[model samples]
Target: MGKRILVVDDEKLIVKGIRFSLEQEGMEVDCAYDGEEALMYAKENEYDLILLDVMLPKHDGFEVCQTIREYSDVPIIMLTAKGDDMDKILGLEYGADDYITKPFNILEVKARMKAIMRRMNKREQTKEEKTLVKGDMTIDRDSRRVFIAEKEMNLTAKEFDLLELLAANPNKVYSRENLLNLVWGYEYPGDARTVDVHIRRLREKIEKNPSEPKYVHTKWGVGYYFRG
Candidate 1:
């Protein structure tokens, strides 16, 4: 079977269009029309990616993203009607990996999906002898697990990926766009706040004091990095 994807949106036309287009690429497609159904479908099965609509009924995309982040880190690309950057920021803040504004071209959607899928597939390639340490925090690239102060910390896949990138290259600052491209390795419309949110979450889990992070540190007007 080809890559599997879940498309969530209230608009039947949009859902049908995406499903059809993705299926043509030989991808297995699952869909839901509302937020509740989306969440249910998400909880029931694992997919390579999720295309979630931001303005969904019942829980909305932000709510569903936040809830799903509690357990799953399947890459999520948000669909939003508003072109506002703030809305895009909010989606990313809620854990979406990417975003597309409404009235989008089918080809554009396909390109974004392919980009993210390519990165995912590339990362799936196994590597040996890569482990990073930042003070009390330890990261295992092979296991994709993190330990802080000798206690394991549960991290979503993307969060772990972000931490791995920074912790592995301590002292090398990364701008939001740089992190988005290198870490996500895709063209995402979401802004820098996405990186900020993940960093905050990581600090909250690994730092003794999130406000004064001893590991992940901001570079004033630049971006973020890690320190021993």
Candidate 2:
């Protein structure tokens, strides 16, 4: 079956354009005009990805993204106004996997979305059926799930991907640029700070103390590495 996607935006023209573009790729597309509607569609169906605009009629994209993080790890890409750097960072903090600035070319949008989808699909297919246990934390590669003392961790797609990569190669320090290229895909145009944001969030979810993390550690000038 073709990939399922949800495209949300208050502007009907933008939504229509994106929907048409995605359909051309033979993917299934669903549309939502506001945050409330977007949340409802997200809860009702399983989508391979979501394209959400930062501005909406109700709740806003940040709130919608944060709320959805409660139960789903479905990849989300935020659409932010051009020059709004804060919007991009805020979207990541709110659990969006990626973002596209306004005035973006349709081709760039498709390339970015396709890159994320392809990377996720490739990883899901290539991962081996095995589990890694470290200090009460369990990582099941087969299920792409993480647990602490047997309680499942509600991780976003990028968070899980970062953690799994670090855990799989303990003690190997990966630079921020390296991680961005590796986990976010080489086509991603995000800066190194994106890696920092994800690492901080991952530590908060999986660490006993975010300030002095046990599982993920920073190497001062170099980058981050997993201790387990």
Candidate 3:
């Protein structure tokens, strides 16, 4: 079966354009015009990807993304009419997998969708082949599981992605922008604080002391590196 995608936008034209474009790429697409209906459809169906609009009746994309994160790890790409950086940053912080600005090229949108789907599919394909071990921590890429001293650690999807990226290349210092682009799969318009927050949260879960994180170390102004 082809991949299923959910398109949520209040604008009828936008929804139609996206549905048509994605369908041409051999994807099954569904649509909702508001956040309320979008949430309903999401609850009743399992989608491979969700294209969510930032401005919607009832809830808005940020809230919808946050609510969806409560129960699903399904990838989300937020759409916004505004070009404001804050809007994009908020969308990411709320768990959006990516964001598209208004007046976007349908081709670009399709390209981004294809890129994200390809990366996700590749991760699944190599799940069994990639495993990272550092000190007492073990990250199994196939199962998407992290363990500390054989005990499982609960990590958010984004947190796990960050750790995986860092661990995949141990001791390689990655700048904040690079991490955001590589792991987040989008250009983050906000300050580096988003990376800091996720890093802190990850440390609390994996480190014996969050203040003295051992696995993920900062290189002052350079960025972060995984100490394997």
Tell me each candidate's RMSD, in Å, in order: 2.4, 2.3, 2.3
Residues 157-183, candidate 1: write the lDDT tens digits.
768888888877788998888887877
Candidate 3, residue 70: the lDDT equals 71
TM-score of each model, paired residue for residue? 0.88, 0.87, 0.87
* Model 1 backbone overlap count: 0
**lDDT of all predictions, in order shown?**
0.84, 0.86, 0.87
**Residue 67's lDDT in candidate 1:** 89
For 1-228, candidate 3 gives per-residue lDDT tens digits of 889999999999889988998888889999999999999999999999999999899989898898897778788999889978877777887778888888899999888888888877876776554778887888988667899899999887888889988988889999998888888776765567788878898899988988898899999999999987
Model 2 per-residue lDDT tens digits across residues 75-180: 7889988566766767876778788889789999998888889987887787764888877889987677899998999787779889988988899999888887
After superposition, the stretches of candidate 3 with alpha carbons farther than 4 Å from their true spots are 128-131, 187-191
Clashing residue pairs in all predictions, respectively, total 0, 0, 1
Cα displacement (angstroms), candidate 3, residue 109, comes to 1.3
Q: 222, model 2: CA deviation in Å?
A: 0.7
- Residue 203, model 3, lDDT: 92
Compared with the true structure, model 1 gives a TM-score of 0.88
